[model samples]
Target: MAVSTLMFAICTAIYIAIVLFLGYMGFKRTKGTEDYMLAGRKVHPALIALSYGATFISTSAIIGFGGVAANLGMGIIWLVGLNIFFGIFIAFIIYGKKTRQIGQKLKAVTFPDLMGKIYNSAFMQYACGLIIVVGMPLYTSAVMIGGARFIETTFSMDYNLALLIFAAITAIYVIFGGLLAVIYTDSFQAIIMLLGMSILLIFTYVSLGGVTNAHEALSNMASLVPASLASTGMTGWTTMPSMFSPIWLTLVTTIILGVGIGVLAQPQLIVRFMTAKDDKALNRAVPIGGFFILMLPGVAYTIGALTNVYFYEKMGKLAVAAAGGNTDSVIPLYINMSMPDWFVVLFMLTLLAAAMSTLSALFHSMGTAAVNDIWGRWRNKKPSLAETKAFVLIMIIVSVLLAYIMPGSIIARATAMFMGLCAAAFLPAFTHAIFSKKPSTRAAASSLVVGAVAWFLWTAFVHIKESEPLGISMLLFGQNAILPMPWQVVDPLVIALPLSIITLAAVWMVERVTTTKEEDAAEKAI
Candidate 1:
């Protein structure tokens, strides 16, 4: 106990010192709203890439989703592919240059600002701002919960206290130094996370004897898939289930597609494009960001699946049962039981780096939305630097309170729900704004409402088996009873996103035809 306490204290001191140093540097450079909010629009591309990668891949990827992969098997690797193709490649090459150019053209500093300028609507600005203000905290709370849970598991501290401490430390840096501080710390945290995961992977492989032995051990446990889940075409981790089964639906839709395409619409990530110094900077950052995002999650998930090798060999049970059958606890249990004391200390720092890096970005985005988008719009004024700083404080306070009060499971579910909703709500409007000419404001506004409302309704009523007629897809197909079809499992994004685009195009066509007829009548009368 004494040794563990001393190790914890030492790791804590190093983390705090590094963060405070970054905060001081940010404070020294920060001069105006531009500096605080967008890193004065001069951040180098490498830093931008690191910042974007770190913010996008957080505790949710490492701890939360890693645990999920440990239970579900290699099917989740589909998400890693999606992250590479959609999250980094297309997002940077296809969308980054245009987004940066347009943001500079309009002097837009936040996502809401970009939306408002594109649509020429003050109402859109406020609406987007409100969405960020309300929606982002749910994501933030999940990150906090993941970090706190790991800390609680390792240190045996009260979970609420762990949550508060994690939230408070991140909030302080974010509140003081804003975006520049967040990115700087993120760069450092990303390095730590990369090193830590690499070490964990190496150790895990060594513990299992080698690659071939690990595969053999996993294959021997093929019958371990729970009986209740067997009828859904669920197979064990050694192989993939039949295509288009419930297991496949969860893997393809929820874990893979939900997070993969969802990356394009992430506000926190989009703003990082504006922070880069130039197109060259964006170009420089791409490989760096893509490499880190791919490697870290890939390693973590691979190690997570190998937990079965250790658990089955030593304990005569799966890691899921070894961790008391809680999916979220599997990774923690493996780390605690398999690693030595020294590496355990490093793992704690790695978890902290992951959680704090992501939390700082979320807080920065939320505060900017509140100060620059919502309050500034309502007052019909631009916020002073001092006012923006105060708004940061307010956001930190609110987020910390939510972290302290909310359940971890609830936070995780809500965070996933928000990501799906954001994809639905903003992807269409954003795509049209950048690529389409003279997009109808009526279409943009209506689509935003339809997407948000549809997501909420589906989440509340249709998605649940017990609440409504069958499942979500069944309800859409006019089925009043449960459908056993794999495709019948509907994620809100798969439905709401297509509906939003259809609504936007349909509305725009009707308005365009009406305007053309009116113009013809006016010319004839003249």
Candidate 2:
């Protein structure tokens, strides 16, 4: 125990030193709001790539979802494919350049600013900001829980204490240095994660014989799949489930489609586009971002599946205690028990780096959204620099409190909720703004109201198992009961996104026809 504690302390000191150094650099560079919020809008391509990758792949991916992959088998690999194709390829290549062009055109600093300027509506800006402020805490809490859970498992520390300590440290750096510090630290953290996961993957494979033997072992344990899952058309990890069953629906719709499509609409990520030097910078950064995003999650999830083999061989049962008798503990337990002490120390640092990188980005985004989007508008004049700093501090405090109070199993659920909300509320308006010449204000407003209400209702009442209707989803159909068919099981995004697009188009058509008739009457009268 003394050795383990000493190892952790050394690793922590090294990690904190690096973070503080980056924060100092950011502080030296920060001269104004623009510098603090958007890294002076001159972030290098490589750092942007690293920042994007690090933010996208958090402890939620490594520890939380890694556990999910371990329990669920190789089926979770679909998530990695989605991350590359949608999160990186489409996001960076297609959306990234276009978004940068538009954001620069409008001088938009925050995601809410982009929406407000594109729609020419302060209401939309406030609405988007409110959604972020309310919804982001859920995600923040989940990440905190993930890091805390890992620490608690490995070091036998109090979960609450772990959560508080992690949140406090992250909040301090982010509140002080903002986006530049976050990006600099994220680049460094991304390196640690890549190296750590790669080493773990190699070690786990070698320790449990070889790749071929690991596959054979996993194949032999096909019977271990839950009978209920099998009945729902989920075969073992070796094969895909049926096309549209619950397991397939959950995997494809919620995990894959939800997160994949949702990446385009992620505010923290979208803001990265604005930080790039130019279109050339964005273009150059795409491949680097894609590589890091693909490799880290790819290795982590692959190792997750292989943990079953490790458990069976070591414990004679396909279970690890850290996971609370669940499969999610498979990765953490494997690292703690299977790897050498030095590697365990390395893995802990990797996890800490992952958690802090993500938290810093998240807090910075939230603070900017609150200060630049919501509070700044209410001020008759621009706020003083001190006021902006105060707002950042307030946001950090709120986020830290939320993290401390969050439940343990909220990671996946919170992720889905935020992604789903972004897809429903922002996707249609954003698409129309970029593609259409004369997207009507009425259309934009109608889309926001309809999409936000529909998504809230569906998720809160109809779709979720026991949520109260009026709580959020009550606006849809004015009922507190669940909907039937795909709505019952499908993610709310599937319904709300299409509904928003259709509503926007319908409103535009009506407005166009009305204007045409009015113009014809004026010609006749003249």
Using lDDT, give the best candidate's number: 1
List candidate 1 segments past 4 Å from native: 1-3, 408-412, 465-488
TM-score of 2: 0.93
In the range 1-526, model 2's lDDT, one tens digit per residue, is 2227877798889888988889878878888787777787889999999999999888888876777666666777888888888888888888888888888888888888888888888888888888888878777777777777778768888977888888778877787777888999999999998899889888978997888987788877788876777876677665567878767776677767777788778888999989987988888888898888777888877787778777767777664344566444566677887888888888888888888888888888887888888888767355555666677677667876887765545566567678878888888887777677876878877887899898877777766532442345455555555566545667778889889989998998999999999999999999
Clashing pairs in 2: 67-328, 456-473, 457-473
What lDDT score belongs to each candidate, Candidate 1 first? 0.81, 0.79
Off by over 4 Å in 2: 1-3, 320-322, 326-328, 465-481, 484-487, 523-526
| 91-209 per-residue lDDT for model 1 (tens digits) | 99878888898899889999999999989999889888988898788788878888888888888889889887887788788877879999899999999899999899888878898
Per-model TM against the reference: 0.94, 0.93
